[model samples]
Target: MGTKWITFDLDETIMQNPFGKWVFPEIVNMLKKEADTEEDILDLIVSEHLQRMSEERFLEAYDWDDIITDVAEKLGAVSAIDIERMVIKHSEPPKIYLLEDNMLDYLEQIKEKGFHLAAATNGYSKYQLPVLQKLGLDKVFDEVITSDSAGFAKPNPAVLKKLSDEGEIAAHVGDRIDHDVLLANRLGILSVFVHRSLPAEVLSLPVDKRAEQPSCIRLCEEKWHKENRLREVPFMENECIPKVVVQSIGELAESIDFIIK
Candidate 1:
């Protein structure tokens, strides 16, 4: 395989939220308790920004003031200033997917093989760095670049390219076809898709093949679960794409064995 560089995405690829979670909207809805309509509106404003951060090229241009003011008007607060309380509430984490056990060890194995390990995350240093440190990846990854740092996010290959060493053949491993695998394809790097939580039936075949089956969409309804709550998986999203897929970083470690060794 001759793979020399390996980059990763943070949110779902490495670890997920403490719970199988929805990001901005779900958190905003939760924190919008009856303190005041102003408080709720403020939460909505923050949620709007976080949603934009994940979905768009937020670093290139963002009108935070406009987002806040518009949200204030929609919530009948009249002024964005009216929503601001003196006592200060910090912004909640945009996403806080906890690291799973041994995900780091897998990377360590990759590192031992002498690959230049790096991270290309949608999240910034303030949030992403701490998680890496907690997972003991603070020193493991040669570079930890982010959307805020790079001015672009996933599905956009620019971040990956910018963070790449420029001399090495690369592979990127992450959990999303929309973001990670797509980035790999666009950048002409090897793509390794990870699907840890899927049921055995849907995972009976590689994702690219399984995704083509009519049974794929149906399986999402029956098998995708966390905390005993079933939710529809975006199975169709994986279709006939990302020639490589694995369920865990340990699997990732194995897939890279030939190349790394």
Candidate 2:
């Protein structure tokens, strides 16, 4: 029998940076002087990064230097010294927190079921590897595939195809619909959406009620568009839909059994 593989996205799936990704106050103050508004700083940073990413064909994993350089050039006011400071601050390693308290135990259970596991993430290996080591996840995953290592990011089937070559992929679990679900669906693997941070109740609420909540608005505007860069891409029903949805990693083992059966 072929090896049965279960692939997972690292960030916000099994683990996450508890502090979350945020612009430093000092950097914000520096950019504010050149930016039209406080929001413009963030807007320009994202736009410039995406523009550069398109130029590179999204194959290479960009670092802080690349983003800071592009943003600084676009602003046309920030000094190289200030830009260097921003890069230094942003380049610092994040403190990782495993979402599930018994995450490793659950993973071991899954492994005992004869399923080989993999972490297929968009993060660069330099960043992702350390997090895995800190969380002791380095010992659990059979394969750790990162954008830098794989030469492609999520939503691109090539990233997952590398693992598919080694075994029959039973399922791919992740927190993002656009990236994780889309990629798995494209490759005909069962997509499992794990809502680690957001619960189903928030999602089930009426659109109007959901709009009243800050989390829902952030999810809709920031996560859906800003982080994933899905604004330009045309939405397809099959691409964003997952075969199975679970609220936590604790629920994943049962879902995996149902999928393979």
Note the Cα lDDT for every prediction shown.
0.58, 0.68
lDDT of 2 by residue, 53-128 (tens): 5554454434544665666666665555343334334443454568888999889888888999999988766656
TM-score of each model, paired residue for residue: 0.64, 0.72
Q: Which ten residues in a row are the worst by lDDT in model 2?
A: 17-26
| Global lDDT of model 1 | 0.58
Off by over 4 Å in 2: 18-43, 49-63, 75-94, 197-234
Tens digit per residue, CA lDDT, model 1, 1-261: 333678887777775432123333433343344224645554566566656654453553234445655664565544323112210122223444335567778888888877888887766555455556655667778888887777777767677665554656468887766567667877877777676765576578754465444455443323323211322334334431565666778866766765333
Question: Pairing residues by index, what is the TM-score of model 2?
Answer: 0.72
Model 2 whole-model lDDT (C-alpha atoms): 0.68
